[model samples]
Target: MSWPHVIPYANPIYFLWLAVALLPMIFMLLIKGKRWGWYQSLITLIFLYISFGGKYWQQGLALIGYVIFQTLLVWCYHHYRQQKNASGIFYLAVALAILPLTLVKVIPFVDGGAAAIFGFLGISYLTFKSVQMIMEMRDGTIKEYHPLRYIQFLLFFPTISSGPIDRYRRFEKDLLEPPTREVYAGLLNRGIWSIFLGFFYKFILGYYFGQVWLPLLNKSLMHQGFFSWSLILYMYCYSMYLFFDFAGYSLFAVGVSNLMGYDTPKNFNKPFISDNIKEFWNRWHMTLSFWFRDFIYMRLMFTLIKKKVFKSRIVASNVGYFALFMIMGVWHGLTWYYLLYGFYHASLICLTDAWLRFKKKHKKQLPSNKFTKALAIFLTFQAVCFSFLIFSGVLDQLFFHH
Candidate 1:
């Protein structure tokens, strides 16, 4: 039997009604206790009742797999922490987890969805969430985990497909701890407003982009001489497109989580206004970059210094830049192109640092032309776009592989 035929009331609009109806109970249950065991049990039953229609067995088994893997990963990290105490081991562990999950995403035999990369349900979301968790663990910022909360953290329906990638420390405490009525009211309004914006972005703008621009890009894919320039120009537009699409997705996540009384992490911060590539990263996907900085970069930088590569400040800075971005690239995917993208960025960082060093060495002899400022902007943007060109995976498709 089909899902709709079997589940009777499983239509799309029914989901919105179910969500609106359940919101108050979820909020009350969340505010009631340290552990929402009762609430969770009830919800699991509801999921069982729906059962993906007759495919319930497969969905249940898939969930069981997630619990087993996620639990073991957390346990292993706990064991690692007891031994090393360095904390950066967390990002390394996260990267390791990504390898297996990436395999599971790409290699269909492992998790049954061989054709679709996102087959393991929330693989994309969990990958980013794993990064967030490991980052907090490394920073010594995460104090505890309630299994129920953690389960809900991963399975929160709104963000299960895509994400804002909330940090454990930021979410766990707020979730376990209750907020004041004023805080709840404010959060409610903010959540509603953000979700409203997200819907407009997704339904209105994203739909338009998919209908108009996406078809054009697909058609231009084969004969991309002029189209490549057009595609590159389109990417600047598509960058804006991606921003709204994903940011809209994030807002949708935050709003839904807020209604449940959980405070999610902020993911974006007016990225376009950023003056430099460094600042651009900070403002864009703010949560993910900070995860890299706190867990990956700081630990690697200090670890190198601890190992004596940092004896000279210049060598240490360059090494730090390269190592961090390398991990950044790897985090994006388990691909050679991602690795190259990492190196490309690392080289740019080295140039940026060296420029600062040279300027300090010859501060009195500097040029004072308006042209210099304009040139810097042009170069920095070009650098960002070129890096995008590499990671876009389009270049790999077109050039060397063929």
Candidate 2:
């Protein structure tokens, strides 16, 4: 397990080794109609070491500690949940689950901009898995807890660094029931296709946009004033780069999962063609948005409605949207741009909701046709790109820090 430090899915060498190592498991699944759980676990450790070893040994250690903390926390919560479902206990468990990630997000701001000692890559995503488990346990969605399965779910190597964020039950089913040979044939084909597509997206197009054009744009914009047309170009360029880079990583994760016989979810779905802000979320980063929608927005709305917090469901839902996105923004970081990015999206969603209601009320008055749909898409694209610009933090560099 001695190779130069490798980021997961970042280089061809990593994937080459991954494919070779996974050969045994793949063979067992395809030829013998069996899953070699022991072999799979061995390779999981090997890949984790390569990704977290060498210069990143500190992060490796941090990841180990984080996993242990989460495993124990979830186990204890599950134990208590069997006897009683207390709101205070559940809230405390959820908070504890997210505490490490919270420190990771907040510490840098207050600690002379130093990264938290306990911080590791994918802490936020791991925390999401942990907290979701606790919530579901409280709701009795998960009747029993299995520690090994939970750890495997959290540390599924393909998605360890970033995620399509598989749910416990969804993932557990794939583990409990190995895909039939016929079903696995489809998975294998799709898996290979996804990996090749990911290469095109991440290595080629992502490189051109993020590594090539973005720097060139920045250099040109530095010469021009902040309000120049080049800034708009930068916005669109950054947006494209962000999409390709992330979507490409996601494809690789899903592809690898499929190869291993797990039906990992897809993250992106041609997001730029969305009809509105809400639809954009449905397409883009589908897992994270869907996770937040299910675990945060829906829960908040339910709580509000249950307690009669607002007279109108619309107002309550709108408020829940703000809470959800604001939490999401903070999870990204405490920077002004990140905060504003969250606020901006929340505002757009609320406005979009209002317009939708208006459109429904005046269905005959408003035209619905291909031309109108195209117009909606075009406008939505511009708005989304602008939000990405804020997300890019160039404005903060140009205006505030300059």
Who wins the lDDT comparison?
2
TM-score for each model: 0.76, 0.98
Which pairs clash inside model 2?
Answer: none
Task: Tell me, by TM-score, which candidate is best.
Answer: 2
Root-mean-square deviation per candidate? 5.3, 1.2
Clashing pairs in 1: 108-114
| Candidate 1 ranges with C-alpha deviation above 4 Å | 1-22, 25-60, 76-99, 105-119, 124-145, 224-229, 356-382, 400-402
Residue-wise C-alpha lDDT for candidate 2, range 79-116, written one tens digit per residue: 98887888999999999998888788777767933563
Tens-place lDDT digits, model 1, residues 108-168: 5455565243234456566667656655655667645456666666665545555666666
